[model samples]
Target: MTNVYLTARFPRIAFTKLETNGFTVDYYTGRDLISHSKLLRKVAKADFLITTLSTVVDSEIIDAAPNLKLIANFGAGFNNIDTEYAKSKGILVTNTPKVSTNSVCELTIGLMLALSHREVEGDQMMRKDGFPGWSPLYFLGHEIAGKELGIVGLGNIGSELAVKANALGMKASYFKPHQLSEDEEKAQNVTYKPFDELVKTSDFISINAPLTDENHHQFNAEVFDNMKDSAFLINVGRGPIVDEAALLKALKANKIAGAALDVYENEPVFDKKFTKLKNVILTPHIGNATVEARDAMAEIVADNVIWSSKGKEPKYVVNK
Candidate 1:
């Protein structure tokens, strides 16, 4: 019988589909990450592997899985897997894309609302010290409506955000390498702005791009300097896209108003210094953590595994 190994315990749908199709499915059940030795042992006898973004499927791991025919990633981003090496070895790599689009887009807006309205700060204040009284100016915050929103990288999430922002009475503009046609921009109700221009003119800046060699550390001290003193930064994309040190400096100097981050430069680890500032809002990378998104992602992964089990092409091949 064919064997399938899951690096972590995901939703049971994946296991059900594999097993229903006569494949033996086994997974790690630890709360913490599985040890490398344990992972090696698990994959060595596997015919297929399911991975999360947190698990690094590097060259060594790939080499150990001599019979591995497929590496199905649970998340939209597959940067954790060595795609080139897998392709070289004729191993198929797949990702569940667009499954988390709505969840992530909603979280992006949630982060924006939390940051702009100082919701987190207010909550902390209420818990630590009882609200003195509702004074007119005690918790003053600017409304998001009528504000200029500059989105970086007009991908699926970014496009959705533009529509939502427009509905909320905010003006949305975006910066991407390839500019959309005038007609396309009108349909999306977003204007195209150059990167420097968008950063300088917008009241809020959001990062929705992927992690790539050309744009790593794209937002640094200089970019922060160019932003308005009252502007706020929101990052729902990869963490390294913005320089954490530079962001800390900018916050300390009041170069910009504040920032909200769902991702960190390093996974499962972040700068504790950010906790000291009331202006900063941090989330534990829960952009796609909603139940609906996870279920959808699991179904997609299971579908791909089923297809590959029948010696057919999977629906979402990333390395193809």
Candidate 2:
């Protein structure tokens, strides 16, 4: 049997499926993230190493696992793994992509609306005390109708947000690394915009861009300065894409109206000052947190592991 070391616990069904498919699985079952030292030690014996976004599978871990054939990631984004290094070592790395589209896109919309409508504040108010009757003067927020929503990327999640924005009666514009064909833009009800103009003119800006070398810290102080004071920023994409320091400075200066984030520059470590801000909404990287998405992710991880163990090319190979 192939020996698999799952660095973290995943859905139970997927675990069973992996074992049934001819692998013996060892795992770290704590609720917390596995430490780097522990990971290096545990992965030494695995033929396949299954990891979550929170785990960093660097060259060190890959080199440590002499028999490692594949790294099966439990989420759509595999930034946590060192793909280039894995490829150099002839280890396959795979992720679940399409399965997360709806769950992540839905959360993107939820974040946009939640930030725009002050949903978090409303929830806090309710939690703090009794039910206060509605007042005409209470909780004034931006209306969703007729707003210009600028999307930073037009990937699966971004495209879906654009489609949903259309139904909400909002205008959609996007800036992608590569321009979509005219038909794709039309299908998504999206118009292509230059990054500068999109940031300056949007009523709400949603980031669905992937993180890459060329676009790191794509949103900085100058970009924030160009934005309308009433504009709200929403990021459900990779966190480092936006310069967190610049974001904090902008927030402090009220350069933009508000912002929402599901990811952070530092995984699991965010500035506490963000917690005090009434204008911002932060989610715990829950873009793919839905039960449906999690289960599907687990299944994909299992499939990839099984195929790799059988010496077959796995689906969802990122290095390809």
Candidate 3:
């Protein structure tokens, strides 16, 4: 029987499934690993290591787990995992992809609407018990209908947002390395534009690209300068893609109208400046936190661990 280490808290169904597979599972729920020495001792014998975004699986941790044949990540983004190191050791790495596409896409649209319409400000005013008489100029915000939306990456979530944006009477444009197929292009009705041109001409900008070496800090001061002063920015993808300092400067100086972010460069430990700004709407990385999405992701993680333990390829192998 394979020895599995459950490094994070997961749904009971996933745990039950893993147990039924006749694996010896050791569970840990505390954010801290008790102690690095103790964790190294426990993982030294682990055959399959299952983790979440919070856990840092670095080279040192990998070296400690000599028996680790596979690493199953519970979420779609495996940026937390060191793929090259894992591959060199013949340890397969897998992530749950496409399972939370709808959940994330829904959050992206929600963020856009909230930021553009000042939904947070409106809610706060109502909660303050300050029900003053409504006036025409009271809390006026940008309208969503008949606006130009520029999407940075045309991946699954990006394409889905385009469809939703079109339904709201917004014209969709995207900037990507390659253009979509004719059928896909017609389905989304999005025009491909140059990155700088898209940033300059858009009424709203949405980023849904993965974080890679080539695209890190892609949105800096220069990119923000190109954006229209009336445009709103939304990011649902990885954090480091946008320079936080540059974004802060833009928001502070009113270089852009407003911004909404679901992820941050140094997440869970964000800059205090964002909290003070009313022009930005921030979320605690809950893009895929819906109950349905969590269940699906857990199921995928369980299946990946089971199959990989049996010497079979997983559904989403990162090192492949």
Task: Give me the candidate number with maximum TM-score.
Answer: 1
Clashing pairs in 3: none
Query: For candidate 3, lDDT tens digit of each residue in 1-320?
Result: 68988776788878899999998888786865434565666788899888887567878889999989898888888888888999999999998878788898888888878888899978887888766888998788888889999999888788888988898899999999898887878877999889989999999998899888988999999999989999998888888999999999999999999899889998777898898898899898899999999999888888888998777888888996
Pairing residues by index, what is the TM-score of model 3? Answer: 0.95
Candidate 2 lDDT, tens digit per residue, 1-320?
Answer: 67989888888978899878778889998999999999999988789988997899999989999999999888778888999999999888998888888988888788778888889988888888845688998777878889999999887788888888899999999998788899988877899999998888899998888788888999999999999999999888899998998998899899998999889999699988888888899889999988898998999888888877777899989986
lDDT tens digits by residue: candidate 1, 211-266 = 88888999999999999999999998899999999999999999999999999898
Q: Which ranges in model 2 have alpha carbons more than 4 Å from their true place?
A: 129-133
**1 versus 3: better lDDT goes to:** 1
Clash count, candidate 1: 0
Give the candidate order by descending lDDT.
1, 2, 3
How does each model score on TM-score? Answer: 0.98, 0.96, 0.95
Best by lDDT: 1
For candidate 3, the 10 contiguous residues with the lowest summed lDDT are 31-40
lDDT of 3: 0.87
Sliding window of 10 residues with minimal summed lDDT for model 1: 11-20
- Candidate 1 displacement at residue 81 in angstroms: 0.8
lDDT of 3 at 134: 82
